[model samples]
Target: MNDDVTCISCPLGCRIHVEKKGDRITVVGHMCKKGEEYAIQEVKDPRRVLTTTVKIEGGRQCLLPVRSEKQIPKDLVKKCVIELSKIGIKAPIKCGDLVYKNILETGANIIATRDVESVEKK
Candidate 1:
């Protein structure tokens, strides 16, 4: 099968052409080494860094922004989101605090993107 994938490794967004035959794959049309590598991996196994918010209790905001520390397998993205949805954190949460460790055995921790201070009762 032949496919075209836009490389997102850098701002260039090179349109990479990929050809797959049985067990072999070839990628072309990339202007940089990183783009070439990205295209090749994208064809083999695509990955993405998951970013979303989880509920936060007793915080200034109702949700705490969280992100995966590393790019996760594309197939595991949904599962990761679902797991995150089922959990909530208590403030005071600091930026980079561990939200979930080794999430879904992906060896990536879900971390807070910003600080969440505890709300004071009047």
Candidate 2:
């Protein structure tokens, strides 16, 4: 199978072509080593940092911005969001506060991205 992937490892955003045949893989069209590495890993196992909003109670806003502590499997992103959608947290929440730990057993914690003051505090 041959695939073209845009490398995000650097600012250049090199268009990388990856070819997989049985047990062998070849990467081309990368301008740097990081691009090459990204292409290989992207083809084998793609990962992405998850960023989304969750329900927040009694806060300045009805939603709280959150993100995965690290990149999780790309395939699990939707599942993680679905799980988070079912959760509701109370404010005031501080930035960097741990919202959810070991989310879906991906070893990535969902952390608050910004502070949300309680409505009563306002």
TM-score on alpha carbons, each prediction: 0.86, 0.84
**CA lDDT scores, all candidates in order:** 0.92, 0.95
* Per-residue alpha-carbon lDDT of candidate 1 for residues 2-121, written as tens digits (9 for 90 to 100): 989998887889999999899888888999888888888887889999999999999988999999999999899999999999998898899999999999999999999999999983
- Cα lDDT tens digits for candidate 2, 5-36: 99998788899999999999999999988888
How close is each model in CA RMSD to the real structure? 2.3, 2.1
Question: Which candidate number maximizes lDDT?
Answer: 2
lDDT of 1 at 57: 98
Separately for all candidates shown, the number of backbone clashes (residues 3 or more apart, or on different chains) is 0, 0
Q: In angstroms, give how far residue 72 of model 2 lies from its true place.
A: 1.0
Clashing pairs in 2: none
